[model samples]
Target: MFHLLDIKKHDDGISFDQTVDVKAQLLARDPDIIDVDSVHVVGNISFDSGLYLLNYDLTYRLVLPSSRSMEPVAFDNQLFISEVFIEEQDVASKKELVEDDLVLILEGDSVNLEDSVVDNILLNIPLRVLTEAELENEDLPSGESWSVLTEDQYQALQEEKKVENNPFSALNGLFED
Candidate 1:
């Protein structure tokens, strides 16, 4: 946590560059996270016109279960984020700033980088995680009585079924005379 007063006093900004290991904290929040590397955050926080601006680059590696195969998949994530923060009491007064940008309301007198990094990490988790092998494989999984079908394949199958079940096919030319 960085004190707002300390940062506010700096004319330029307070720069931070460090690697923090929040593996335990991350695992506690998400059981699906199989592994996590130390997070590297490099950024600056500056105060300007009653608003605190935070700009940072975050890099980390995460191992998670594959969406389809449930196998562990490693993801190397790099993100650049910029956010505006306002003191809780000054929210009403800084309404214009809030309206102009996505402002984070400070509950206390400090900024918590770990919390922000963790939140962003979770939010950025890919919905579909696939390994190299999975990406190369085109065959869909199948079982004894069930099989996965692509959207186009399913639509074609439905049309074929409708045509086979229709009873008016034999009388199609009867009305031509």
Candidate 2:
């Protein structure tokens, strides 16, 4: 909660440290995230040069599914928020000049950082969650003819294919001349 008076009155600004349970909200957005253990937010909301600066550190613990095994993996992500909040009246002028992701407009009497924080959370979600336990198990889906390739394996394969594809490079001079 950003009280209009609190920020304008305190030069040093107000500090906030709280745990907000947004498990339901998280689940609604992404079903792959089984549970959101907790969301911790700590920051200072201060006024500077006609703009309200919100600098906060957001951390959340989530239970996600492993990429390969589909097992639950605990993931802790930390996101730093450096956002500027402007009054709604100022939005028309400011919005045209600014990028959408960086600044948030304060609609009414106060502003809420929840929406921005949630947006950042969405941006930070990893495409795949792999646990150490999963990595340690050398048995990663292999058959007699085919096997799961490690990241390095696929990279090496691409390099080999690149070289193989360019085998006729020495004959290029024939066409150039």
Candidate 3:
């Protein structure tokens, strides 16, 4: 929990350089994300007369399921998150939310950075993660009736299919025959 007192005391804002743990919270947010080792945040909180801003860099590691192989893949990600907090009173007074006006509304004086931290981490995770060995091995799962294609083989097949499915190919075939 980030203390509200610091920002309240310092007009210029307060600086924070510390690490926090929210492993349980992370799992609850995303089931695919597991084993959240640690979260290191370095930044501060400041507020102008209009809005309060939280700017920080989030560094954390978690295990994610590889999009292809469905195996566990670990990622150490560094992300920069900048978010503005709006009080309920401001929204009631304002007309509408505009583009580039995304905000986190505060329930009270103190704000919990954990949710924001996890959100950025999740958004920045790669859609696919392949180990160096996976790339080099060129191994694919094969069954009695079907086989999985490697990245290279899949692209080659797509190119071949495009040529075979050409619209004028039937005329070209008749002439050849």
Query: CA lDDT, every prediction?
Result: 0.90, 0.80, 0.76
Q: In model 3, what lDDT does residue 50 have?
A: 49
lDDT of 2 by residue, 86-173 (tens): 8877766676545655567677777676766676787788886877887787567677998898798889999988877997966777
Q: Quick one: best lDDT, which candidate?
A: 1
Instruction: Tell me the spans in candidate 2 whose CA falls farther than 4 Å from its real position.
Output: 92-101, 142-151, 158-177
- Give the TM-scores of the predictions, in the order they appear: 0.87, 0.75, 0.77
Better of 1 and 2 by TM-score: 1
lDDT of 3 by residue, 61-114 (tens): 878876667778787878888888776677654435423467666788776877
Clashes of 1: 0
Worst 10 residues of 1 by lDDT: 94-103
Clash counts per candidate, in order, are 0, 0, 0
Residue runs of model 3 more than 4 Å from their true location after superposition: 3-6, 92-100, 138-140, 148-159, 162-177
How do these models rank on lDDT, best leading? 1, 2, 3
Which candidate has the top score in TM-score?
1
Deviation of model 2 at 154, angstroms:
3.2
